[model samples]
Target: MEETEAATEKAKDLIRMGVARAALLEPQDKVEVDVVPSALIIGGGIAGMTGALNLANRGFEVTLVEKEEELGGLLRYLHRIYPTQEEASDLVKAKARKIRENGNIEVLTSAIVTQVQGFFGNYDVTVKREGKDIPFKVGVIIVATGAEEFKPVGLYGYNGVNIVTQLELEVMLKAESFTRNNVVMIQCVGARDDNRNYCSRVCCMTALNNALILKERNPKAQIFVLYRDMQTYGTLFEDIYRKAREEGIVFINYSPQRLPTLDKGFVNVFDEFLGEEISLLYDLIVLSTPMIPHPDSGELAKMLKVPIDEYGFFLEAHVKLRPLDFATDGVYLCGSAHWPSTVSESIVQAYGAASRASIPMSKRRVIAEPIASVVDEEKCIGCGLCEMICPFKAIRVEEKPGGRIASTIIASCKGCGVCGAACPQQAITMRHFKDEQLLAEVMALAEGT
Candidate 1:
């Protein structure tokens, strides 16, 4: 009888604790957003065309805008791709043909995005085309604006004649006009320096590829490659590097502190292995320069409200988790626009970006978290503190009839409680995280009731 009485008392205490904990709960409503099933692609390069075709093939509308008059961005200036030695023009032509045949894709050449407004799921973009404005709305935006080869204008005596960039070498190779038999390829020009301290990532492999090509053209050519480091990453590229060495191509390592000097048709470089300085005679000098961000990337970044890296390349949301996405939803990045990537890498990233964009368009609706912030207009002073402090731009203060008031953009809010902490008036309350509700739970736990 005493044991039964003790059990009944314990059950009553448990029930009382459950009731007290339940009082901490607050109701919340989820935010549902309608999605627009269309995409706006900037830059009609291989990456942009590949992404556009992927979406259009899936029965979604795609508007491809290219600043140039025709398609094939950087690929248009190339002779052949490495590893395969296939003509770069053929790759561009095939992708362009696929884009043309896809009925769902609307290609706009010689166009520039003049204005961008609205938020995710609905973006109003104005394209300037031939002295006219064309406005359209898209569900998502893809930036594939690509990069440019850095011009070593004032470095290495680059005159675009005897001395030229790797890109210029490709042009000469394409035209069959490179008649020079004694060539000196200098790697990392205008890259990995105090001014621009980043590897172009493709320079070393490009040097190897071009050196091998020169060897193929003239079996008797004496080619010397001077580099800081040979960044041949993959086995295939490493094999190419080995093949270049086998073909009697010479590679000399040089230090940045003691750089090679151009003196009267000879490159005087100190060979680290030999511990001696050697003068190599050259009929042509190829400066393997880095790829740099386009000049207009800043304007486009501001228009899209996306972030760029220190080097002006597009920054992804998270490098590991969300590599192809921006912090802002409905936007994606790919290709050399993010960094200097090869043809194969760019194509792979293009497909990944297209897949990420398909999620929202396929769903047709996005559900926002219920635990968003709420503003009490009665207590809000509208000092714009929340607006200024918000990292995600989820809150805004606007003029009302009586005074200014703060509002929360539910879809964009991550419910971080930052606004609540910064608000001076205590007008902002993060739903489900109110002070009283939290205190009640604390009190109940402390009291053990």
Candidate 2:
């Protein structure tokens, strides 16, 4: 800790030789408590809000950070929600109001976490808001930074005026002035395709909801929903599928192997159910697509020392049993960033995440199992191989003034010994998962020294 403060001061000296040493640290190292704190909840979306509310209710001083100016995320943009047809803004506003009123919840809107430098019980969090750096130490972290809406700009010329995504369609519907008579909606544009092959899980229900709205407004309007498969596989959704069909909304089936074609005024698509190619004149086309992860996920994963799956979903510690937890002891994940889920599903996930967060609140302090690694910085070459190999981003190279670079950050280190396997100089080793633990057994088996 002394060396960390010294190195930080020295680096600042380079930029301002005359600035006093007192000004170097920038009030940047905030300890949530004078001692290390128990937890941090990232994002202010549904999952994050739920996690914070739960953890705080259980007696933890929780910090909830949101990158957006507002806390509700996608839910805020929605006017009315499905099945119940309840006003979406009303629900989000209630949560936002609850969070603000809760004394235990520390809300940070338009804030970003620049650094998450510690592990389970001793994480050093650096948050930036309005040019001020606030630092805090916490025992746990909850990653509920939900997903961004997918954009189909290139594949089908979605950038045009009439062409819009499901999110934009929501805005139009909320505006209550859409006079679209021949509205055509296309499905599976950016999802379940060759490049991105996972079903988004909620597009069908969304299309069904909007179709009902169109039917209620302009009775003569022709609303068309074209899709390869309608995956309404959950409770209440199947009922919605029937209601859409009953309301005179036309559903067309198409082979995903082929692409939908559009011209200046006419749209051409192969109607698979009808076993024929057909053309239709339409005023507007809405693309019902699934949510995608934000572009900054890789950077956030690195800062938090977490792993993202091949499909770009953040990999939790366990799939079913620990559905909302990361591989680390004090970190958790939930919502669209994990995968496609409905508004209700997101709310439920937020609630579960909050319940999980309550565990840390019940405890006064956190204790990490002592299987994690430590580094011998004296011999570290700082080549950045072990840095890359540790999927958790636990290894970081820090330059010390008037000395060679050093590698540290014990709090972010997981117990995995893979970093030792990548070291040419053998400078890094997990405390309990030491190389000698395996080496001695191997030597005895080989009958060699």
List TM-score per model, in order.
0.89, 0.82
| lDDT per residue (tens digit) for residues 292-360 in model 1 | 999999989877768998889999999999999988778899999999999889989999999999999
Residue 186 C-alpha lDDT in model 2: 91
By TM-score, the best candidate is: 1
Look at candidate 2 and give me any clashing residue pairs.
30-135, 37-139, 38-139, 119-411, 305-392, 373-430
Give the residue spans of candidate 1 off by over 4 A: 1-22, 379-385, 397-404, 422-425, 438-449
Q: Which numbered prediction scores highest in lDDT against the true structure?
A: 1
Model 1 C-alpha RMSD to native: 5.4
Which lDDT tens digits does candidate 2 get at residues 189-210?
8898777888888888888888
Q: So what's the TM-score on candidate 1?
A: 0.89
